[model samples]
Target: MIFPIRSKAKVLALALLVISAATWLYLSVGETEYGRSLGPVAPRFSPTASLLGDLESRLQEAEEENRKLRLQLGEVRNEEQGTGLGSEGENSSHCDHRSLTEKCELIHVAIVCAGHNSSRDVVTLVKSILFHRRNPLHLHLITDSVALRILGNLFNTWMVPSLQISFYNASKLKTDVAWIPNKHYSGIFGLLKLTLTKVLPSDLSKVIVLDTDITFATDIAELWAIFKKFTGQHVLGLVENQSDWYLGNLWKNHKPWPALGRGFNTGVILLLLDKLRMIGWEEMWRLTAERELMNMLSTSLADQDIFNAVIKSSPSLVYQLPCYWNVQLSDHTRSEQCYSELADLKVIHWNSPHKLRVKNKHVELFRTLYLTFLEYDGSLLRRELIGCPTDGEQQETRQEALSKLDEEDPCYDFRRESLASHRVHLSFLPHQTPPADPYDVTLVAQLSMDRLQMLELICRHWEGPMSLALYLSDAEAQQFLRYAQASEVLQSRTNVGYHVVYKEGQLYPVNLLRNVALKNAQTPYVFLSDIDFLPMYGLYESLKKSIAQLDSYRSPKALIVPAFETLRYRLSFPKSKAELLSMLDMGALYTFRYHVWEKGHAPTNYAKWRTAVTPYSVEWAPDFEPYVVVKRDCPEYDQRFLGFGWNKVSHIMELDAQVSRLVFLFNGSL
Candidate 1:
């Protein structure tokens, strides 16, 4: 290695400057091995795909803690056993005659009404059996005439001196019976034979009856200890029985003398009265009232089919009980804590035929109790002799309450003060102009038989009276009356009006050209032409001045298109310029209106125009465009693809991604 040519050209320029600095650092880090790199410090990662994404996120948190411990072990084996009662306190005294517990006492209960009418819905069932009785009872309101005569004087002025109240009357019962029925006796079997033969108690034993639109929220000593744990020596406790009570056929040949189940609701019972007076329940209520056996049980389901045939032979003494003890109120179960779940309501029952309607929270609580006794116009014996009156009869009762404040208003006191002031005043008077364009344009064309010379140049350029329709696929009517007597615009439009349509195929030309143009097109605007497009001289006055400037701004519930034309020609021996541009790409010239083709009920078919234009886009030139092709037969003309032009450029890129400036009126040029 005896170098001399200038030190072997400086050792070949230091070995080509160390091979051009290692080919410029491997083309700047191997020119991005998978592309893109300017030089960076390495970091990269994958620790075994980050420990398999942290063990697939702790196996989805141990399958969500084993689906919450199998839904808390199927809700601890579907729980069950019930009973809860709460909320009721204010020194709560429905006459407190203590018995707190020794299995309960304070018994003097009596709800024995004579001719019981709904006495203001039995004052919410004697305020839900005096807010859950556990003693301190006494209602015994036996009545005679004035249907519970003002609920026995509002229960003798809201009773409660340990309650004790009585009223007795069927002219003081001593048997000549008659509890109620001079005439009106349909249901509740003439008031359950006027309460077990003239108001109960033939040595009482235990009674409960109920049904004046029931309502007792719990504790009638916990429903008398579940009615002495199902009346041990049964006579009645009620409840269990619903297979809609053996759906008729006279309960399958009458056999169920004590049937054990399927019909009870004498709307909440309890009864035992010493086994209803030793099984001759008052001589079966005097032989069901001298054999009327409730008109021989002809099904009015009144005294619930004669207490289900006098307890069908005593099916182990009759008990059943629990549907949360008598809920009833239907229209799919009523609510508002169903009247404070009245002690878990051992009764509730308003049994709907829409229970006397009114409810909007009882019409705003009787319009706030008629604006809190709208100046009390007494007569409950002058509000029980004005016990709380004077400031001179409350200032002469506020000047006779402003002279009887429009005779105590209330039919929902102005709809509960207009739904508690959500305002509604309007009294009428406002129409300042603007309301005119109610449609009227009608052009229809649709002829066929190889377009009778383009339907005689659209009846020689339609000068009004245009509604042709013709369609005839297999030509008849003597070959369309010999091609309309050699067409001269069908001998100068004999007052242009034809509708033919006999095409029995291709579903008879889409249902006989939309049912002969929706039953003889009587125009409110239609124009669906096809006899080879030749409408150029101001195309029907520029589509009726763009539909009267779209019915003067704001009337476009549809028309967003226009401008079209296409008439090329050439096809051999028996015609074929590709069958004349497949009959000029079949979108028969269009125009619309007659209430948008009477809401697309036009020429029915195309599945009733895709169910009357749903999700929009109905076609058949749903308004075609491009230099409205007036005449293009040149070397098979192609003015850069026309009308329905790539479906109006994919409906203008879906109307520029749903609506904005969408004015399209092309007249074909490219």
Candidate 2:
């Protein structure tokens, strides 16, 4: 080693030369593809082998844990079986298992009517409970006069004699005490005072309290059975798990015992009277009601808040049932995930004033079903029940009246005979209006000129002065001679009148057609007719009656809208014809005179007038079809509105002050 060290200078020079060559080679070759070809291959690990080893260890550990847990569970089960404490077996008694001598009886329920009254809803609740429950039950009505009078009478007259019931006036119990600010509190203070002051029997074991609006669709016996089976360490209550900071703060400040769950809805409660007495709950209630105590605890919580605070910290006595037992009636549509729970709802608590404003079919069905629960008689029953009369007496009486009136009335036979004859012209007069002078109600069949032959029978039977305005577009006429032939056929059918208006020169087709009609119409009122719309025999008579009822200004009192029945052969176009037909069929039949024009109304303004009045009026055709307007004063439709929704709002705003009243006649089936 010493001899080698003697040549350190020479060795250092050699090492430097070697390092420089290696660096030069690396720099020159590594930058090119040829350099990469000289590199060593990397080694790969066996991931599968590693993963298997990890899994095997986990499996052994899990098996060991499972064995220990099973052993512990077995020991606990043996102890429970020996003591006969837990009612886990199929043969376990539904009643008190601890004391074999005692048996559970029917639960006595009392409805506490506090702030508001829902007597009709309560009646349904009572009826539903009675119908479904097999256990012997008694309903104790505790309410003020507002709830008692309505519910008492309905129950007395209608409820079958099989159910046992009693009524107690809660108002007579001096229970007026403030439990919360800005809200009227009832029941808690009053009921507590009654129990403490010896007004109520202290010996009572248990009582179930329900709100007035709750509906019981299924038997509650199973829930009661579960409650009885459990050790009576705590009073049973329904927990509203969604309680917020307001409730938490109440508990914090009041320094009451903490409970596991949050807040409980006072709407439904089960009180263990014996346990409450033993715990001196009456004295606690009295102290809590005192002004000094309330002032101190008021910031912490209300009566419920205080109760929860004390109960939560002291002992675990409260239990929460399924949410379906008390379904909250709300506006937000429940998702499918929540439907299973909602479908099984036994009690619906309508929590909001706007609850009925919801429009879902499921909610509507729920409401209808709930209404059936309150059946007073057939009339009330019919509201929820199908094929039932709303009133029990009306069912029998209306049937008799309908039968007798059928024999006495001759109009029905006349209508039948007229329909069978297939007469082209007939008259329908309003029941209130007298016969007036008949004016020529011109039925101008405005078609695309190709549908002329289809109108031959309609034109031939025009007994009232009628006219035909054939509006043919340049394209339609230029493209096909069949259209021209159809127009010629229509003209030949009737000599009442005919005007062939070529739409080639007009800027807008509909406007040009209307202008032609306005210039040619000789009648005081022009009937706006679509090509597909056909008049039944009594159509003009109906128009005359509607026109006669108009005010002195000759402004239409109501437009006699035509009812259009669909024909099987006519094919509809999606973009143009179908839309136009829909507008003609479904657009509002009634138009306001004020909206047409301020100075005077014309036949052209009828289109705009109809749009404005249809939404507001009740007078509509059964088929949602446009009404036949036999204008008393030839109200011109605004020709500027050639296409739909064009200048419609501006035109409507202009005539806002002129329309007085609108009538809509809705056909019930549509």
Candidate 3:
């Protein structure tokens, strides 16, 4: 038997050698003749049946041996590198199953967006996730009521498959972390992460927490797979800070909070809820915070400082994630080492105050990724919903996670109730509806349901696109849509757009509504006015002609249309500027807001508008906010002023600062 095997081996070696020699001889020729293979210089000869069969058998044996040897080599390398084996005790089989689970399982993510202007960052972040996600997502958002309402309205229109969104009132958790002093610009909201274990449902075993300024470039399922790699003692996963801010070497008198070696950034965190609850994470962190605050005054980085302090004392509680997972793009560091080693970025963290505009060599790439999601048309995500697994899909697994929590927890009822109250509904609003036909100008205004009557009047006279941002509840918004549909003037026109914004616990956000309206206007020109104002007949065409005559549509100019108001709401609107002037002389009409706030529109100089032949330039004043026909890209309204006072003034001030000249047009009045 040994002699026969040896003979077969010798034949195989000789056969391989002959094949190698032929290939080498063919390659030695020039490129033009290489493919011709020397025209089979020697005549092809058939080998005996017995010899061919023996050779084929030997080749198969050799290939099988090679494959077995490679498997042995891989096992040896994995053992030497201390790579962990799966629960099944087989590395290869475990990896295959793990990958399959990652693709099909549900992923839970938590984000904190507690104040105004957070929508921009949250929108970009969520968009990036939905853009690259494969597994179903159960998003847990911690936010205030205002943020909750805005985000709910926005996400309600998105019909992403297997996507479930839930909101928790950050105000409910405010008291939990308010005692921890924080100087971060996000205020107490920055510390909201400290309450995640308390904010989320007790049944949820783990969740990926992220800051709003991060954008994902890879499938998040890959990141979730890291959780399976966590050791028994590890309760959190985080990447080390890229900059020297935590090293206390930034400047002469820099007083950074306490941190471990280079410190771990809190921008991206993987939480093991079961492990944390079993180890009494809340009590442990409270003790750590007390000790750290004794030496330091307050935290500049909020929860990041406290998280590092705890990790410094108990290092085994954390699993160090790779740097590429959270590529920090602050001015202090571009994460050059991570970028050089990585083939593709997993997540981009804009941790600096400059955000996407941060000064980094890779800023453009990061900014482009963010903007791609920022401008991404969300309607594209509204495909037919593919129902994800329900709570009963993994009943046993969920119960196991739930069993980890203390059964006698005192705050369980309160936490559950609080979360329930803030849980927002999905798919309540219609998809964003744009006008079917394009227009030269869009009439932009904001109003509540009480002002729904004015829409018909304004739409009838304007005879152009009307972009209205309505502040109403979900029910009220539906009712307003029904009303608009029933109206002949509004329903008959194809150039009326109704943008519904949810009204929350805060006061009327007039400027916020205005900004929403202005931003939604798709025309080259927009008429920024109040919903209560009635434009004169032929005002839309008149303004179009005036803009053409002055050629101001392309310039940073606001063509002021003189406004007149009468006490009687049912009075006929003026047909022309001449008729408006006659009414003004007879005291039947006065400039809009003239008696109450003259400086607001006095800059337009209504007296000169009475007889002006051509558009006259009006220098901007402090409170000047004339209803004007301006390019849609003019300065946006400041959202800080929610109520009536100083709402329009700040917008006008920004326009003036940007040198947007205001000019009075004599075409018509609003």
Candidate 4:
């Protein structure tokens, strides 16, 4: 083993080089589960861990940036309690108390509504939000063609300050979420929530998605302030499900979707759009659904099931909201405990098939609030467009321009078109203010300038709300406003709304005028009539009594008010039904259009109406144009019919076609 010093050194260097080569080769060829090589690569990193780390880093960056912005704005969040953003505590006072100006941000709200009656619920939901809102809103609606038409008309008429609306047709997403099986009555509409981030504008970073069946008791600004409290790693905010359906103990063989604890209700949700996109939410949800659908037949709660599944898989993504924000009134859940503990109810969610009729001890209180918003006068939401000091200048300019309008030539015809395409002006002069309590029945009618005289006589006889759509030239409209201001009877009333449609080119859009009047009406019942007719004495009060007596509000029906006309314009108006009958026997009066068109009044069965003591149903007949008291949401008058011919006839025919019964009101008439 003896050798020269240089020979031994060479041997040591060669051995070290061989060992270094072996280690480099081993590192270049990465190891697999079976210790196999996959070419030169760095040491492996766990995909799960990397994904988690990247997501956390992105969220932390966002959180820090937001915190810095808040601090710059002179806002400080409590570090000791960690802002209590997603805490599950019941007594958390996380609501921000800063000035509205400091947080003057547009609140984005999304709603998925379809079907014919969906707009009705949505109207109430919007009303509830507008009732207590301090901040402006930008509402996003996902609806069908039918709901689009109805909601378009309604929201366009509502002139709330800083309220902006955008609509997306639900049909565009028919293919995206349709593959998943669902058994809920809402059908595919319930699944539309899964595609909100896809359907809404890409720039939208956050939104509040709400079910149409809910109402708000507090300012929506209170809820909007919550987004400022979200910490890193939280992408959604939701309230816990109040029912046991998710617990899988509702029945013997119940096989509900998998959930963590009681699950989360989807009626109200806060989505962080940017965070969701960053996490590849589409792929995440699709893969999750593919895995869960294998063990289930169909989802009972649609998107709700999938949402809970995702939350169960990643608990850190959700921020739990307070129960008061979503007070579930379903029959299967008892919210009395929540009510007893909370100081104020924030939102009411009618989340059951029975809705307000759900079997809950607090149903009456909840129902009362629901109906209050449902029957609320939409005109109250028409606050003037006053905003910040800069906005105030714009508003003042607008007011000056409008005042000039009042001073312009009353006879001059201005092509003033607003909101509608037909060159018509809506609410040219709306009611001064809404009544303290809504009128039981609003008298809805269409009139011309010549019929302006009838307004005084009608207002004298009827003191309820009157929604009048007038066909006037720009000049006549001015004259009408002057008349309204001068006439004591008309000036004193605060419940009369005047909607004007310009008398364009020879064809008078009678039906269009009628629809405007009907749509503007705020009462549950409206007596569709003409401006020339004067209602019999006490007809308004009597109809109110009859409405309460018949329970007509619950079961919608057309209460036929008998019509009679006189040949002489100067004849004394009938004071009572007995006097009208006496005059009829004396041949002083005849059934409306009786001499000219028998078919029109013949269907009313005047002979039977005179003797019948109680309301009786009448069969539909051709040319029947009897003025009737019907629900405000009745089929609109056919705009195709112009001038006087078949205008009312077509409307009554449509009502009859819909199987709506026409019953004679005992003594009411116009």
Candidate 5:
């Protein structure tokens, strides 16, 4: 195009006119990109290769800026999702607004859980953090590599975008604790949180570490707040522990009386990483090597003592948190659900040195709360807070706790009554029928190893019409059979059959064991008995008459005499039914022939249930009735069932199914 040269001012005026026109055109009749501007409308320069390069450079800078902005935007979205912050139905009561309201920072939370065995407790603790804390988090676990791997995989499975979890192998910390006695705290569970100060990342300025055996009732953001609360010299932020021994130790030994409140529970601690770094761990290790320090540490509560001793000169160095922050092993009176209000409790610590020895049913009842919380997704607000009074386990666990506390409180009323209603009983009755002719029945028993004397006593005391066959497992332990033979019990007895056979696995398959005896029984009639059972000849005679009266001596009849546990040892083997009866306890009725909870009805007594024992009724408790005198041909036991518990149930189930000309009878011999 042809153009005339013009002055700079006129050209500038023309450029301004074009820019004004383009702005008016854009406002009136828009271009591309919906709801966005297309930059300056009038071009400053015409299109050229070098101009495009400058444009590309500027575009590259803008692209980089956009990339950074997108990254920041993504982080905000992730933080919102992960923390559930500003989201409906999330914990907001104690969330630090300053932290949550701004660009979310990862609140690094350090926890020391020993291993996979401790995973359940850690899961609960971590869940509690998620449920309560409305901030991005970095969960650091001080545990074995194995446990770290397990938790890492679990956290990944959870896929919480806002939260980042990492595991530090604290197994190496064992070297730091190597000198401590195994009976001591460090020896038993490793060095614990003391080594955590050394193990945590040096770059991590602030972190809250807690023991696995804890539950957070408050949002963990409140815990993180303590790091900010710390004054100049405080290295540790911990809950004031009211341990009797710690109080006594401080009072008796340290010149100035240290307040009990000054004693801290390391279970929940906030570490000032920067300060701990300055404290110098070499000095701590040096204290361990010193004779005087080791002697002082030899005291039972050594872990806390080391902390106390190091910070003794300046108690101000230990920032004591309120007692409610960590309630230690205190609530034993009611289950957690029974708590009318947990408003005061921010955290609860199950701090018994001997939790395994807890005897208070109330304490155990309270423990159920901790256990339930552990199983929960770590949100207290979402939990069903009611005591499980109906749980049979609550009763059992309470009894255990009570047993432990029994020596301490004599008048502690065991609210859950003991199970004194042993539904099993025995009564003496005169024989209604004359004794039948003695038909020798072979008594077969399942065994891995037999007590030679007990087996001989059972065999010798076994009166007219009986023989013994033991299906010994062909385990390496079967060599105990040699011990049995060496004892002269077999030599002293008659027809004591010792048959050893190999079963594939290590387990004592009770059904297969019974089937072995069933198939091998030489007599037309087989009396299945446990090796421990002592058969009374007199009872046998009465039972034989019952079978003969029913004409089941050779018929397919299953005669089960209710068995009884005896105080009688091998030496105390009763010769007659009268003597055996004296040694007998209550009937072993822990088992039911039929499940009472299901369709099958459990009988009230031995006599009432006797007629009902068969395959037709699905509800039957066919158990070790001592002598199940079925014909040798009666369907051999089903070997499909496994273990001591299910194998016999399978047999009962089969018989109850009416598989054969099956008849159930209660012979009075047991």
Candidate 6:
């Protein structure tokens, strides 16, 4: 919960600059406060008096506008703090759900979340929902104590009058959720949605209930409109289930239950509160109280399953919403099938990692959209002032974001993977000024599918006239072939080159890819690293001096520069090399021999790489193995290890055993 001092300072600076600019503009109009009180002073035909009069008028308008903004702000704050929940019977306008006649001016939306991490997702999801939808949102958030603090700060800081919200601690709501007899779960998560009739204000009907892990592509009012389409007994509406995975659990103890067909994901449910109160509440709870039902629901218990089962016999009770309304991202089997669905999607549900990895385009795009909302600083009334980037501006921001990839910025991340067939034309930007005795190290790395961004970062910091070669695998050819850069930003340097070693369908050659970079190295000294390894700030500049020492050595040797593990998720590297090394918590300096194996999930199966050297405090660790720096052609990387796995160990052993009697280690760590 600790805030970054730097970020806070930036936000303060931005606000001050905005206010300062406005004041400067007013003063520039020559309507100083002293002159304004006395009205305009006549001048000899320079139109100065006329201009001052106009300036005074505009200032009045500005003050009036400012007053209106303050009033709106006060009203929103007051409503959030003092609005009372009156009984439903008191509101004569309130209608019954059985009639499907609930009327309202504001669009009421509810989302259920628990735990700390899920609370973060709730904030982003709500922001995204508000950013796209042009309606008054009465977002009802249900969660525990931790979320109450986090979300309260976010909503209070970001709340506009148009997007008013109220947070209700789920545990505080009176419900049967805590009455799960014989169930190990302290409170059933799924049962939260079932308690809406009892928990939410009785007058609030036709509310849209959503799972926390969702992003909106269109106004939720569009989804809200689907409720009006519900006629007859069709009260509950939802997108059909993503896969048949839930069928087994639904029918596990079944006396041959009816077919669910495509089963439904209650992730985006448009509930008819009126209908639930009239048709299913008591019966549903009775079924829920059944010892066998409670045990089953508690064990693999799904509230959605119970709801779907209750409405199963009469299909009319469930109105099937469009697939795009709950566009299932986890079912990514059909590339073409997904393309058509994406074009029409209203909401996207990223339910699982196996369903969509971080690399997927939609995942990335959702991430970008998610950030856009979270970073907004406008008041609720000023939501109008919120970013409404034009098509040209949006494309410009994306393109600009591309140029700053070396910074590893999240804003520039365009996560729509539909670019699979589209090639990313990359240009390498080098140091603006070349050193007097330029470093001739050709930095080599193995490139793959989503790593062009990684290369961009290396290139951004590839200062002082150096060469970099990216060895591309068969899997990455198409992307580079038809890349979109009309002008060459990547080709900005002649020293940068790319070679495709493995063609499409061929297995990715790990060691061979490294050897190609080593063999083709055009420099006297070569620095071998992976695509993801971005050097510390001064590593490149210092390497220029380090290489000089390497060349003068009477005996030829390898320079083993150390590396560190990133501390924060998607953390940006420190601005300077000193800052990078000084940050004891940002990165843990890896003192162990850098291995070639793909270290799987650490703290789990993969071995945790560490040393007796304490994190954030380590100056050095004893040199181990051939994480060896090398003189080009003296001891080239061995290519015996094929495909993947254990590719670098043999090469290190060779360098230590035979290549050089004296190994010169580069002391500067990345």
lDDT of 1 by residue, 56-171 (tens): 67556655655665554444323311111111111112212232333324443444333323443444565556554545455555554543554554444332334445655644
Residues 272-388, model 5: lDDT tens digits: 888877977546534633534444435355455556555554577777665556666643332232223456457767665565345544466446656555444321222221331
Best TM-score among the predictions, by candidate number: 3
Model 6 deviation from native, Cα RMSD in Å: 25.1
Compute the lDDT of residue 244 as modeled in candidate 2.
Answer: 43
TM-score for each model: 0.20, 0.37, 0.55, 0.54, 0.40, 0.40
Clashing pairs in 3: none
Per-residue C-alpha lDDT of model 3 across residues 319-406, encoded as one tens digit per residue: 8777777889877663755655334578988886676667778778778877677656554553432454443323344346555656
Candidate 5 TM-score over all chains jointly: 0.40
lDDT of each: 0.42, 0.45, 0.72, 0.75, 0.52, 0.55
**Ranking 4 against 6 by lDDT, winner:** 4
Instruction: Write down the TM-score for model 3.
Output: 0.55
Model 6 compared with the native: what TM-score?
Answer: 0.40
Greater-TM-score candidate between 1 and 5: 5
**lDDT per residue (tens digit) for residues 1-670 in model 6:** 5534334434545554565569668676454443434335743334367776887787787676666655555454334223221111121222223323223347888887765557646755775676666656778887776566546654553434455577777876635655543232324665678777777888877799988878887777677766876777877887776655555663556421223675677788888888878886756645634634533544333556556666665577787765667766753442213335344556777665344464455666665655455443222323432333222333354456555464454422222211111111122221232233434566767766567666557767764233333444322343454351432655565466454442312344466557655665556666776767777666766776777755665665556655656545666666754554556444344323234322321111112222212112111112222333466675665544445555665565566566444344455455
Which one is best on lDDT? Answer: 4
Instruction: Look at candidate 3 and tell me the lDDT of residue 395.
Output: 34
Winner on TM-score between 1 and 2 is 2
Candidate 4, residue 316: lDDT? 93
Better of 1 and 4 by TM-score: 4
In angstroms, give how far residue 451 of model 4 lies from its true place: 19
Worst 10 residues of 4 by lDDT: 411-420
